[model samples]
Target: MEQIFGGGIIWTIFIGFIAGLLARALKPGNDKLSFLWTIVLGVGGALLAWFVGSTLGWYKPGEPAGFIASVVGAIVLLAIYAAMRKKK
Candidate 1:
């Protein structure tokens, strides 16, 4: 079981969108993202979650999270993105 690429890329992106939307909605804050950015964030976050989940084996193929997990994962990805951008 791997959180990073559970199920595959297609599934990852599909679930990533759902996760990202929930993540943003649940933890909406400052900083506005265009449509593209949100998708990127979502997809990236899902990939990140997959990798991270793989480390802990928290995510399994064909099964990610209900909601909370996705939010947490996306939040982490967003935070990491912000931090990296801040550095650049």
Candidate 2:
């Protein structure tokens, strides 16, 4: 199986956090997530990228996207979250 930044979940979380932060910085408007939530956003974004990328043949099984793709995934997720919250 392909690996990203090596084995285990720690590296995945680390990359996800960084990707999430970058995504927040790259996206416009305000985000009210706390530190923990931010981390969740990042990790979730990375996972999303992995799933979607793999489905689209953009990534191999067990292989996650790089920084850019991760950030893009985070941005999309953030936007969706924001929109859903706004409607509530």
Candidate 3:
């Protein structure tokens, strides 16, 4: 059981990293995020997508967001992050 839980975390991290990379590549801009930040962005994006999708009935409860949706969510987060950073 421990192994399963641990593996799930590792897998989530891997997916998050991939989603972040893809979002960065697809979105046009100079995003200077570190490796860890990228992963966080991806994971955050996934969560955002999940929330939005759930609210819109696009995703059922407990269902994970799709990769494309995750990437899109990451891009949205990146845009927002950039905007906030620009305000500083």
Candidate 4:
């Protein structure tokens, strides 16, 4: 954790929170999502963030790219969720 402690965890959490919120907002019938679902969106987005950062070189040896990548991933997921919902 110390490796990231220099500066990243907090931003990651914040981005996760925002990403979940955006996901919820973009989700069709998002009102039906429970609190647990929101947490999932945030955490899942955070996980995706790592991949995005590494793939795009946003993730330096020790940087705070997780937050932005997570947010972007969450937004993409939310858009997908919205599209799927639209099909229904």
**TM-score for each predicted model, relative to the true structure:** 0.60, 0.84, 0.89, 0.59
The parts of candidate 4 lying over 4 Å away from their true place are: 1-18, 22-31, 61-65
Q: Across residues 16-81, which tens digit of lDDT does each residue of candidate 2 receive?
A: 678788888988989877777777887777667777888889987666566677688889999999
List clashing residue pairs in candidate 4: none
Clashes of 1: 3
Q: What is each predicted model's overall lDDT from 0 to 1?
A: 0.65, 0.76, 0.83, 0.61
Candidate 3: residue 81 Cα off by (Å): 0.6
Give lDDT tens digits, candidate 1, residues 4-76.
Answer: 4356666666666777776677664664677667766776776565566756777665565444555677788
lDDT of 3 at 6: 25
lDDT of 3 by residue, 1-88 (tens): 1121123777878888999999999999999899999999888888888878889998876677877888999999999998999999
Tell me how far candidate 1 lies from the true structure as C-alpha RMSD in angstroms: 4.0
Model 3 residue 5 distance off true place after TM-score fit, in angstroms? 13
* Model 2 misplacement above 4 A: 1-7
Top candidate, metric lDDT: 3
Question: Best candidate, TM-score-wise?
Answer: 3
Among all windows of 10 consecutive residues in model 4, the one with the lowest summed lDDT is 1-10
Q: Higher TM-score: candidate 2 or 4?
A: 2
Task: Give the range where candidate 1 is weakest over 10 consecutive residues by summed lDDT.
Answer: 1-10
Which candidate, 1 or 4, has the higher lDDT? 1
lDDT of 4 by residue, 1-88 (tens): 3232134566545555676887667655644556656656766776666656767886776554455556567667677777888899
